[model samples]
Target: MTDFPEIAAANPAFFVERVLSVHHWTDRLFSFTMTRPASFRFRSGEFVMIGLPSEPGGPRPVMRAYSIASPHFAEELEFFSIKVPDGPLTSRLQRIQPGDPILMGRKPTGTLVLDALTPGKRLFLFSTGTGLAPFLSVARDPDAYERYEKVVVVHGVRQVSELAYRDLWTREIFEDELVGEQARRQLVYYPTVTREPFERQGRIPDLMASGKMFADLGLPATGFDPAVDRAMMCGSMAMIKDVAKALEGYGLTEGSNADPGDYVLERAFVG
Candidate 1:
C-alpha cells in the first residue's frame, strides 16, 4: 500500500465540488471550465491539483497540477489539458461532461505570475502544449497591460488544430474597442507549430537561436536587456531547460517567490 498524506485523510475536505463543462480543441488538446467555489482564491498564474472522484474499491484518486486558465477575478476556473490516451488521470478525465463532478484541491501555487518579476517594459510568455494555460490568465488580466508596455505571448504546438485558444483570445483582446484598446496596440500573439505549416514554424528555442523571432518582430538582436524585459516559461521539461539556457545567453536569470528577477519557469505538468 502507498502511504497517503495526512492531508488526504478527509477527501471531501480537500476537494471542493464543481460542475465542469468541456471543450475539445483537438485529439491531443482540450479545455474545461468548472464552477468556482466562493472562497477559492488564487493568483492569475498559479496551478492547483485537480482530480476526479475515486471509484469504490479502486486506488485513491490521481491528482495532477493544472495551471489556472481563467483570470484572477473570473467567477469560474478554467484549465487547458492534454489528453494522453493512457494517462492515469487524463484517460478518465477526458470523458467528463457538463454537470460532471470534479475535485479541486484547496491550495493553488506556482511561480508564473506578474508579482514574481521586477517591473519591466515588456513581458514575454513562452509556452508549448498546455503550458499556455497560465499565460491565458495573465494576458486576460487588464492589470498586465498596466504593468508593461508590451505583452508578447508565443505558443508552439504540434498542429494547427491545437492552436484553438490563441485566435479567440487575440480577437477578443485586440478587437474589443474599450477594454482592449491598449492591449490591441501592445499585445502580440505569435503561434508556431512543429509538425504543421503555419505562419511560424519550429520550436521556440530554434526561433530564438536563428534570430527569426526577433527579425519578424522587427526588434534588433543586439540590445537584448533583462533590465527592461521579463519572461515566463512553461512547457515540457526539455523545452523549459532549453529556453531557459537561451534566455540566460541573453542575460536573464530564473526567479521565484523568494526573489524577484528577470524570468520564471513553471512546468505544465509533472512528467
Candidate 2:
C-alpha cells in the first residue's frame, strides 16, 4: 500500500490511508477498499468523512461523508461510490487507482446504525443507487440477524448494472463463514429497477404502498407493521422524503443515534 506520511502529519483531524484495490462496476459507479487504521473504529451502518489530498500549495482538501460498505469486523475498509462527472469530489475520486492515497476522517457517525432502532421481528434496509453502501455493512453484521428475525435489503436503481454489490447479497454473503448461516436463514434480497427490464420494477415507495413488496416476501399484504418492523433508509433527497412519508404513514417514527425509534434514515448521504 502507498503511504502519504506528509498528509497524515499535516492533518490531525483525518488519517491518510492507502487504497488496496478498486472495482469499477459501471461507468457511473465504483467501489474501493483501503487500509484500516488499527485506531479507527466504527459500528456497521455508520458513515465517515473521506477525501483526496490536495495538491502541493493548493487549497484545502475536498471531503464528503461516505457510508462504510464493509462490515465493522472486516480487517479492511470498503466504500461504494458514484462517479459524478463534474462533481466537486467524485469527479476526481472516480479516477483513483490501487496504491493511491486517500483521506478518512478520524470520527465516524450516522443514524443508520442498528442501535438507533428498537427491537422488531424484521429489519428492512431501503436504498437507491449508491445509498446501498451502508446496508452492505449492516446486513453483514451478525448482530443484525440476532436483533431481528429477518434482514431485508431492498435496493432500487436506474439500471441493472447500477445494482452494486448484487453478488454479495445473492451469493457471497451466504458463502461467508461468520454470517453465512444466519444470512442463509434470515436474509432476503429484493432488488428493483426503474428504467430497465427486470423481474421487479417500480420505486420503493410504490412497492411498499401497494403492498407488492410485502406480498412478494410472503408477508401479510397490509403493509409495514410498526410493532414488528424496523427500517433504515438511504437514497436521493426525493426518494428519502417519499420513503420517509411512506414509513410515517405506516406509523413508523424516524430515529437517531440519541433516540431509538421504529425507523431511521441517513440524511447526510442523500444526493
Candidate 3:
C-alpha cells in the first residue's frame, strides 16, 4: 500500500519515488536526489512539479515547480531547494530523509533551455541563490560545450557560504573524463558575494554595467554582444528584469522555444 493514495488519485501525472540521498548545503538551502521512473524524461535546464503528500484528511498534495539540477542523462533526478521555515512545502520538505517518498510530475518543461537560444560563440549563465540550479544542469550537458566556444557561469549570493557547488565547478568537474578537457579550456566561473567580503563582490548587473566583470575576465570591456553572445538569466524577478534591460541596451533580444533569439530568461522557483 502507498502512503499517498490521495496524491495518486488526485493526479495520474505524478510519479511517487523514494529519496535516494539528501545533502544540506546550508541552514537555508539543501538538495536531494530521488529515484527516477524509467518513463520520466526531461531536458537539462527544465523544471518539474514535485511535492509531498498532504496532511491526513486535509486536501490534495502541496506541489511546487523546481528546476532540475542534474544533467538529463543521469540515472537519478537531483533538485536544489531553498528552505523557508514557514513555506508550506519547505517547512516539511526540509525534514525529509533517505528512503522518504517524494512526488514528481511526469512532464518537465521550461524556457531556460539551449533550444531557445540561437547559436553563438560565447554562452553566459547568470544565477543567484538557488537559481543556480538550472544552470548547473545546463553547464554539465555535453551539447553546451560542443555548441559554444566559451561557457561562463556568473553566480551571485549574499554570503560566501551560500555559494554551492564550488568544488564541482572549481575542481571536480575538471577531473571528470567526459567534459573535463573541454571545461578546462572553455569554462569560466565568477562568484560574487554582496553582503560579505570576498575576492569578488557586487550584484551581477552592477558588475556587468561597470565593465568590471568583463575586465576581470579579460574579455571586451564593452560588454555583451548579441552577434556572438548567447545568454540565460535565472534568479529573482528583480535581477532578471534588471539584467534583461541591460542586455537589451546592449542589443540582445530575449528568445523562447518557439523563436530562438540572442538570450532567454526564467524565474527561479520561490518558496
Kindly report the root-mean-square deviation of model 3 from the true structure over all alpha carbons.
1.7
| lDDT for each residue of candidate 2 in 1-271, tens digit (9 for 90 to 100) | 4447877877667898889999999999999999999999999999999999888688989999999999999999999998889989999999998889999999999899999999999999999999999999999999999999999999999999998888889999999999999999999999999999999999988888888988999998788899999999998887788889988988999888899999999764445
The global C-alpha lDDT for each of the candidates, from Candidate 1 onward, is: 0.84, 0.91, 0.90
lDDT of 3 by residue, 96-137 (tens): 998888988888999989999999999999999999999999
Candidates' RMSD to native: 4.2, 1.4, 1.7
Q: Candidate 3 overall Cα lDDT vs. reference?
A: 0.90
Model 1 local distance difference test score: 0.84
The C-alpha stretches of model 1 lying farther than 4 A from their native spots are 1-10, 175-179, 269-271
Q: Determine which window of 10 residues in candidate 1 has minimal summed lDDT.
A: 1-10
Candidate 1 residue lDDT tens string, 1-271: 2223332454765654555688998888889998988889999999999998776566778988999999899888999999999999999889988777677889999999899898999899999889999999998888888999989998888888888787656687777554478887788888999998888899899998898988887678763478788899998887798899988988988888889889999876554
Cα deviation in Å at residue 2, candidate 3? 6.6
Best by lDDT: 2
Model 2 residue 193 distance off true place after TM-score fit, in angstroms:
0.2
Q: Report the Cα lDDT for candidate 2.
A: 0.91
